[model samples]
Target: MDAVQVVAEPRRREILRLVWDEERSAGEIADRFDVTFGAVSQHLRVLRDAGLVTLRQDGKKRFYRADREALGPLAAYLQSMWADRLDTLAELSEAAERAERGEGTDT
Candidate 1:
């Protein structure tokens, strides 16, 4: 699954956002959600399968956090697409400016 699919679920997205800054225990993360722990676990499984998160064992507890490397590709893809959109907007803006200056398409 891609990053988009991984983050498509609202609960999963919230989990990722919460864990983005620091590693969080399963219970700690689960507590923030209204759903049951089992439900949250299922969401984490999807995220882990998508390579968006990593789990580390600390004694008997598991700590989860966002995988920076996995998220990097997604970020790059979004940046590239946003840049193209910005370029299109810039071109439209320049055309509008020229039109305002009486250098429209008819001229």
Candidate 2:
């Protein structure tokens, strides 16, 4: 699956959040979840395949971290969507305030 599709799952997104800033081993990530280690492995596999994360090998350990540059498009899209939603929320809040103050009431 593509990066967008792969991250559509909340669990995978959570995994990304964990590795976003720092490199972590598979075992470290699995420890954060209540699910089985195998399940976490599968999620890690998906993230790796989707190019959303990078894997590095150090001795016997495999570390993972988010590929920030690879997430540019997705991040921009999400930010735009968030901005739009916030704009809508602000408009609604202002209208509600006006109603509360009886400044724009039709009644």
**Which candidate has the highest lDDT of all?**
2
lDDT of each residue in 1-107, candidate 1, tens digit only: 78897776778867887787799999999999999999999998898988888999999998999886888766566446557878999999999999899896764
TM-score of 2: 0.69
| Tens digit of per-residue lDDT, candidate 2, span 1-107 | 77789878988878887897699999999999999999999999988888889999999988999887888788666456557878999999988999898787564
Residue 2 C-alpha lDDT in model 1:
80
List TM-scores for all candidates, in order. Answer: 0.66, 0.69
lDDT of each: 0.84, 0.86
Residue 8 lDDT, candidate 2, scale 0-100: 86
Tell me how far the alpha carbon of residue 106 in candidate 1 is from the true structure, in angstroms, after superposition: 42
Clashes of each: 0, 0
Candidate 2 achieves a global lDDT of: 0.86
